[model samples]
Target chain A: MLLEVYAQTELRSRSQQHGGIAACLSLVLLLLVVSPSLAFAQDQAVAIHLIDMAQDSELSITAASLADGWYDESEDSRVSGYELSDGTPVKFADWYHTDWPDTRVDLLTQFGDDFGLLWGFSTGERGEKYTIDPSLRVGFVAQAHPAANSILSLTVRAVAWGNLNEQTCEGDYGEIGGVQTVNCRLAATFLPPEETLQYLAHAEPNRLHISLSYSASF
Target chain B: MTLRLKYLVTAAVAALALLGGASSSIAQTTSPVLRSWMSPDIADAWTQGYKGQKTTITIVDDFTSSSKFTGNLGTGSLLYRHGEWTRLEASMIAPLATIKSQSFYSGTTVPLAAGLNVLNLSYGMYARGTYSLSQLGWSAQESSIINYAKNGRAVIVKAAGNDGIAIGSVNAAGNKDFLNLALVGAPSALFVGALTRNGTVANPASLASYSNKAGTNTAVQSHFLVVGVESSKTGLAGTSFAAPIISGYASILGSKFTTATPTQITNQLLNTARKDTLLNYNAATYGMGEASLSRALAPLTIR
Candidate 1:
């Protein structure tokens, strides 16, 4: 198609050569008008996103409070089995208070800001669940960017362990004993680790979880 | 990187760190029982498809027993940690188990018959000096409890009694820490004691300072068990509260081990408990170890 158009232009130019300067002006205008659109039509846009890609992913932040008491220090020595006497639980001059927050981040590979493959990891000290296996999550992520900067993320987990392993959840599992027929469940806090209920297992220890508010940038 | 971009990255990292300690302050109280402190994982029992469907749990305490929800319904308030209160806690555990209320001090009785019945006795007679079951003469109401002990169909879960006193001797804490004298000899009873939590930490589950433990002399300790029950609702701590959780667990076990007799259910729950979690894990203090619904429900061999 381009060759045909060029040949036609050449013929027209040859015919209009007699008009000289006027013809030259016409040719310049014609060439100017046709080149850009033609070039554009033939070009394939290969968007290369080195960081925070749009189709690849959107930046998201998640804050989940861990399971209550999963990290709690038993109150007083007697209650925790440290002290048998009702004598008040002796507090160390610096009794390290029990507390820690759970948070994660998801970074996409695309800059389009619309959506992309999710990749993120969680950061927090492991709780009792670690007794069985290292329960920290790191890996590929799935996210939906519903707002300008907010990303709604499914649970953050290392890609090594597919998305379905229940142990990937953050919380303590009681030491298994006997025939292992039953497991009792106890919920100490709200899901997603809201401020009021800091003790909740932010991620489902036995299931997948959806979480929020990841801010994406460069 | 642009200066602005650097600032943005720094801010993001800072925000994440801020979120780590962002949980609002809760005047956290203690309870080995609150689903919060100890991860008993009782919810696993439900997944095993047991919700105490065919099980019945009876609460025997100091108040009068009545069907209606009047204050007459055995200390009507859930705060009493007695009848109604116990029913409330048991519901938290079993959710679907049948709740039967009776009063020992009031001399009232709820007729006991067939089916998987687990009685939780949170109250005990204060009359001093242990009495052998054969030599004792309790009112038929009390004797009926003895009858429950004799009846193999029912599981009796009584508090080791929380006078902080010992049954046959004083404890290391020098408290009168002993099991209740009146209940010292019930053959079929599993005396409940309050465990603080899984005691790899501060206190063992055995004698919660305020809870009574069976002394060495009676060997009644062999028939006791411990459970965590720091009432999140009311900081109320005692074996009185502990007994009901076991009662609820017994009912849940009944739901699964349908044909198992009450004695079998009782023994299975005690035998399969997870005591390794407790510090000093003594039999006298923790009894048949801590009441573990999950361990009891475990299959004989790996499934």
Candidate 2:
């Protein structure tokens, strides 16, 4: 009876060991199949952000009252102002020459935005004072679900304005050296802002908004 | 002394007369200008049954009738009848009519005789859609014709059309009607284009400027040859006339060299052509340059 019991025990032990080996092999195979897919998912994930700097701002200028000694109109009219978003205050004339006065916004992220940057420029002279206005804009909206490994986004962006121009014009109502002579002149500086709403999309993206973006994790 | 001197003078005159006679005979017999311009001996050989030997050719075109066009008669009269030229400039040059078909489907089998025959076709229909030789139910017909040529049956020559368009450019009209029936990519076929006697590359000869250009592409460009045909009265212009010239040359070569196959004859003719006169080795405008009959027949001529 003891010999039969020993033989049964040996058979059970061998079967259990075989089952364990099979289970271990299956686990390794599962890891092998899923590991590459995980790496691919990680590679595909890209983050994009739009930075807006536009804010309420004002400028003030002060000049000493002086007798006419050929005062420089440009230097006299200089003023300073601050932008609310970044809290960076700047001079009006300096800002006009620099990129800060331009309304164009920059995209801030380690990974670049999907859309390209665009710019426009125009120039004109109105009587005496010269004005230049530049602008930049960018925005995007994305949606993601926990079950899915991709982000779907309908990105509507307007980078720059169209029909920007600079020009000089003069107005005068005067007759010189005639029988009856009267003189009147009115001239004002003007810098027209570029029209920005021209970039609006007439239609929207698809209703499903499901896009499979693939990338590598490493 | 006086009598002896007279006799010597007479002898000198006689000798001079003999020398003059010999020189005149040589001049009459051999002049480079005469040989180059046209060889009467070659013309004689052509007149005395030396024109092409009995050969066969297949003309793939539409509306070929012995009655419709006088050139279709295969006689020297066609030249005068159509005002193609005043007279046969050369004796060996004549169109020999063998067969005519009204359509691509004309169920006529070209006969393959022992010697050389020339097939002159002046028409071509553009192939479009799925109407390949097999698809259009012409496989058997094409096979039989190809086999006949392969067996040294005939020298098949066709006129490249006067469309001025590259081959394979013809498309179906709005109503889906086919413009041409010529097979575009068939291997056995020879497509001939037209060139002028002025030997100007890309210049339009007096002939109609409508002759199509060959392409480097597979279908339209591969099966193309160019030969001189009378385009204007001056001499040789259209593909119509070019086809017949080739046919005539093939006949001449076939008569001179009995052992040469149709493909061999074509190769010899193309190889001997004046390549420098043309724009490129093989231009879409002129395939293998202008046909040089003298060069092509040089090897077969008995010195």
TM-score of each: 0.47, 0.38
**DockQ per candidate, 2 decimals:** 0.01, 0.00
Model 1, span A96-214: residue lDDT tens = 11122222323333223233344544333223322112133333334566666455554333422212111222222122122221111221111111121232223333223445445
Instruction: Summarize candidate 2's per-residue lDDT along A125-181 as a digit string, tens digits.
Output: 111122323333343433333344433333344433222222222221111001111
lDDT tens per residue, model 1, B140-159:
56566666776665888877
Give me the candidate number with maximum TM-score.
Answer: 1
Chain B, TM-score, each prediction? 0.73, 0.59
